[model samples]
Target: MKLYFINEYLGDIHNTGVEGMWVYAEITPSKNIDKFNDFFAALVDEENDFEEANFSEEWVDDNNWFVIDDENRKKGICIPAVYPDGVIAWRWR
Candidate 1:
């Protein structure tokens, strides 16, 4: 399993009124970022609920959305400043 610092909440497809929070997911990393984006684009958790985030055709950018970190250190609330230049991948748990 790989670790990812993700901002899945603020994308165009979903939201939870908490855009500043990030999820440190220990997931099976995806092969590529496109696959990662597609997987999440279709992800809709009923338990979590996204029927109010106004579903869209797109989400975050492949080059600017997330980063894969095994050590689990990426500040989503304050990014590019605290953590600059890191490998981004589609992490799955």
Candidate 2:
């Protein structure tokens, strides 16, 4: 139930599709154990949010979160480098 907005470019050269994304967030308990397990079910539930949304299993395998590219990349907001909430944060803002 937490949200994050990483203002810094954290990905490295080895990372492709996301490495150039400008910014991204890492959400844990991501997709959840239930949905994740359902994904591997022999007969996957066709109605699953992930399946319905057409999110690749690989995307789920890797962490999933919000990503954005905005002119205000590092503007107007700031949070601790290591936030106490340990849930949501706006790094390097």
What is the lDDT of every predicted structure here?
0.31, 0.30
lDDT of 1 by residue, 1-93 (tens): 222235332221111122233333223333443334433433433355333244333333223344433365442222211111122223222
Clashing pairs in 1: 27-92, 27-93, 28-92, 28-93
Extract clashing residue pairs from model 2.
none
Every model's TM-score: 0.20, 0.17
Which segments of candidate 1 are over 4 A away from where they belong? 1-6, 9-60, 75-93
Expressed as tens digits, the lDDT of each residue in 1-93 for candidate 2 is 232223233221111122242322432433333333333342233454324345454433323333333432323223212212222233222
Clash count, predicted structure 1: 4
Model 2 vs. true fold: TM: 0.17
Against the true structure, whose TM-score is highest? Answer: 1
